[model samples]
Target: MGVFDSHKSFGKAILYTCSAESKDFFKVYESSDDKNVILSPLGVFTLLLLYAFGAEGQVADEIVEFLGAANKRHLTDSYRKLSRELSSMDPDLLAFSDNVYIDNQYSLNNSFILNAYSYNSEADIIDFRNPKSAAKTINEWVSTKTKGKINEIVSEDDITYDLVVGLYNVIFFKGHWAVPFDESETREHCFLTDDFQLIKKPMMHLLKSLDYFEDEGAGVRMIQLPYKESKFKMVVVLPSHLNGLSMVLRQISETGLLHYVNRMNHSEIVINLHLPRFEIKSEHDLKNILPKVGISSIFHGDAYGVVNEAPVSVDKAFQQAFVVVDEKGSTAGAATGLHITYTSLTPTIPFKVDRPFLFAILYDDIVLVAGTLSH
Candidate 1:
């Protein structure tokens, strides 16, 4: 099926694919000490779509299959529509952007450049020989796009000499809660971790009408908290068992995130909500993780159609994400860079997120950010 068949289908594809990828990402960090993780699937998907536009041979085939696109044309056209929709939003509330930095030594295919323009993506030629300067320029652009939420996604060390093209995508969102939690009502509360450790954290409480659902078979409850004057929302999913985060994640991986999210269409009702004020910033080296999800060919010099002259392959792929949820609302931003490489609830009904849970920020059907809070 083509991604452009309908917006619902396209969004569902994105959510399913990205949610599975997020599950894989969490597996990579399962053994680590970090208790919180955040990343933008949309941002990373946009970057890959851009790369696929210029890809040919097996590289193009692999990415198209991974992205679930019927063809490159369908992929590019769908992204163009998605990009336009995102850009039409109030800039102060949300912003989306993409860029391609090509080395001066090589020129981009005219058709690829045209496709980039079709999506309003910026393409610039820079000197990759000067890794430090290139990194600074790219970092500045990303910082500006994300409004400083993400200061850097790439460093000089990431810019290798063999790098030919660097693809980047960024998304920024800041919205006030439709029914904001009163700051005065926020209090320190005990949060039980997955390991049964009780940690005190600032918890924001509010009683309001919100979309909520419970899946007894899944042992999870979900809630959707909307943002002021926007379709954007924060969906939180809490497990019935205190240490059931892994079980919930497995459900998402097996049934798809859209499956659970779509079931939240019941009705809005007033419920007691207890959400913790949290800020999570995470950085990932995607080279090691991408292969686990079947996107490994491009890194091995399989990508040659992007540049007009010299053959090039992705050398590195990185993503840096930051998110903050408090009494007022949430502010989240992420930057994904392919250094050539590249890469619920709730619930209303007395919903208390006192344990590890999963969450996502969505603009309509597209998931902008997804992660987990374990402590």
Candidate 2:
């Protein structure tokens, strides 16, 4: 079965896999009812993968592999801190990857008391191998690396103390639209809720000429919107017009991904996409959400995932996620900070996000991020 065939959503995975010719669709994005979110082939594939793998162990593996042995220790320790940050998040699936470096300038060596007068200056990534000394330094290094995005890299009280090191953070997220609307030619009128409440909202409308299909068997309408920046970037989906959003979501699976993107080529079609402009900002306390995603058992316990060595387990994982959606296009991002002690921080970093456009992260067939309608 394809990855999308599982419970994970494919929206994030599709956009990260669009192509140049398919990108023409991104030009359709317009929150003002003047433009609609368009996407290319590559964009669609990436989003699909992002949707399926965001929560899977694969993302974590990718980050670990990227860091390699060259920076594994720091990355591993920081992973614990970032994990706590991520545990606090409530997103469906969100992820990002980047590098972390030590700040030599901030390196400070302190002392101890050997007969009331002793000091030591040992530097070399502050070996956490020494549980007592290691945990402290790992915690300190974790806090130092993420600027305190993570506090205690190694929990368990016996595992963490305080020191300093570098950290690489990866963030991941996924959210369902609060109000999923159908795509049609919405009139230039006021938007109303199910209660018939009136509200002023910009609705995006489109007349797509290609990559359009209506699944009568599935009872839904599907369309693909490609981004303009590159070919491997787009958003494809089964619109909720035909059925309720929840029902439609249940009907979707991994295999449906390829069908949606591959079937579309060039065709004339009409589309009206209406999505709320939402600004979501979150600060997750790792201690809150980790147990929910199945990570609690290990991090909160004396893990058995190790042998013949010290107890190997996660310490903390937390994160912060943000996404702004509008008519012109959409922008979504996440920052996951964790403390693996035995392992990492934030999915994304400080970036310059402006205007209406779409973005995605693509690695071969796996698309890690994608979103639009940020008008």
Candidate 3:
């Protein structure tokens, strides 16, 4: 799949809602004092969709509404197809995996098991009471799936006997730049933050012809740096004003994201790019954030259809993300876990990222991860 290929497999509503959810999640994550943040909204959505399959009543309704699906079947079919398509994507560029772990106390649903497999995923029955072993097993699974980029996703503290099920999602990506940066040109440069503080960092320099755009209306400079596979790229949005990151975040939406892609110019020109080599490792408790985006029912409401026994509600949901940007390429890994304890072308313009900014790693219309760099 080409980076600019049409997203015909996915519904427009899915794309819109996913991006909106990503932005909403970003809002919650940005409130944290730690400046650097990263999240895999797509991964989170997929896991929730899997939960929707086993959900009924208000739980089903809420998850369906938040996912922008007309019904549960619609959402499931769409996610099934999406899983197939994403798994079929070039592995060298991206890898995605999902797994479900249910406590042996409950009988697993055959349909749910089959559906998971159809999506190139699997399910397992584990003993939640044995928190130490269960946590280690879950962490090992995540580490193996993410090429060791992520680990300890579910600690002993996250496990309990009341926990009935757990869903896991991991997305790993490693793609080389279409035009690599010169290592010799990398130098120490001062990065100004929103608070007017400066920190010297190793800034990578590259002069190349790349997809570029300047959105005056949004007051941000957008640049697209494609990967060697041409199916993925890092789109950076740098606010024109040093302290304008909040403004850009306030104005960002699904429309804004599409605008970035639509407004991108393929015309290549000499660009003096100065991007800092940075590594961001972030962990977020999304339990509080999902409700803000119209997904409140699962936290406290009765969810009926998950199993044959009794009603269940999600207790813990979180995400851990890792991203590294440097002269060579970008490598990112994200894991979204649910504990049922029941849980460019840029132009040659001076594209120096010397301040707080936002970035999206995109594949077609789907936002694999959305993040902010305030430091």
Candidate 4:
């Protein structure tokens, strides 16, 4: 199995919330043309699932089951509660969690699996099918919530009207580092990957000494990297000698990142921060990954359910995420929706995915703008 397959495919559970034609949900999301950091209501909702539990893998599976069989009343409440959970991130970060809002209905097409837009007029059909009013409203709120940085929200055209009904709640965000680095200080440096690959990249270096301290008691080491502007910032929390990083990520959700960020104290210590200007676009397929986590029935060849208007069913869920980090600022975009679902009941224990992994997340003040992971 691939490294992130389990983590990435967990996103497919978001599809369970809608009827059969959830592929139309993804079409609207993956089709956005804006270049700034972007996320659809579907993506945000799936991410929210990450926050409400401890065993991400199992919770993801349970979410998929709930999405498929749970009643509409439960779905409505769950959607509403998802927003409340979003507030855990930095107020600034959580603020971008709003951007688009939707409220409407449309036809449910079940023509065939793997074909979200089988009809010729689907281009116009999606524009008319405005589902998930609550989610769309929240996304729109994020745009104003984060200022112009977040930019645009998801529109109805993104969803295919072929789905009986669906809801969207998306958040888009863009922000510069709270502390900016001087151009004079920027130079080329080597970035070492986990597999021992060395890549020479335009690395930003800031050499300013400051007071530094480590407490074995706390199991964390905090370092602050400053950017040119007061709003620009980069803070790295390296674990103590014996402390594992996976432990930190498992204990800290996106909101946990913000919680620990604020606990840092400022002092006149020396800071030597070297980071690269890089861009990563990851496309995650849910086929092999979903089964490993126990939610296999939805996409398997023998799976059966009525999510769309026709007899068609989802065969797979595809997710694509793009991120760019530079001296000026950072930008990211994520698109996710459901491909399938099933029936199951189980309270998941907190499953830890810790096994020598690295994670770097972006934030504006207390808000977490983006999070990057490597294993």
Weakest 10 consecutive residues of candidate 2 by summed lDDT: 112-121
TM-score of each: 0.93, 0.43, 0.92, 0.47
As for TM-score, the candidate ahead, 2 or 3, is 3
lDDT of each: 0.79, 0.34, 0.77, 0.38
- Give one clash count per candidate, in the order shown: 10, 122, 17, 51
Error of 1 at 132 (Å): 2.2
Best prediction by TM-score: 1
- Mind giving the per-residue lDDT tens digits that candidate 2 earns over 205-271? 4433434555766554544554332332334443334223223333443243444445554554444
Say which candidate scores most in lDDT. 1
User: Model 1 Cα RMSD, Å?
Assistant: 3.7
Better of 3 and 4 by TM-score: 3
Off by over 4 Å in 1: 1-9, 21-33, 265-268, 341-348
Residue 108 of model 2, lDDT score = 21
* Better candidate number, 1 or 2, judged by TM-score: 1
Over 4 Å off, model 4: 1-61, 64-171, 207-263, 266-270, 300-313, 340-357, 360-375
lDDT of 3 by residue, 1-375 (tens): 432233333344444433343434455555567868888878778888887777788878877776666778777766766688789876656889898888888866776677778889878888888999889989999888788889789889888768888889999999799888899999999999768999998999988877788878778788888888756788888999889877776666545476667677778566788998889988888887787777777777765656667677788889899899988999988999876543304334788999999888877667787788888
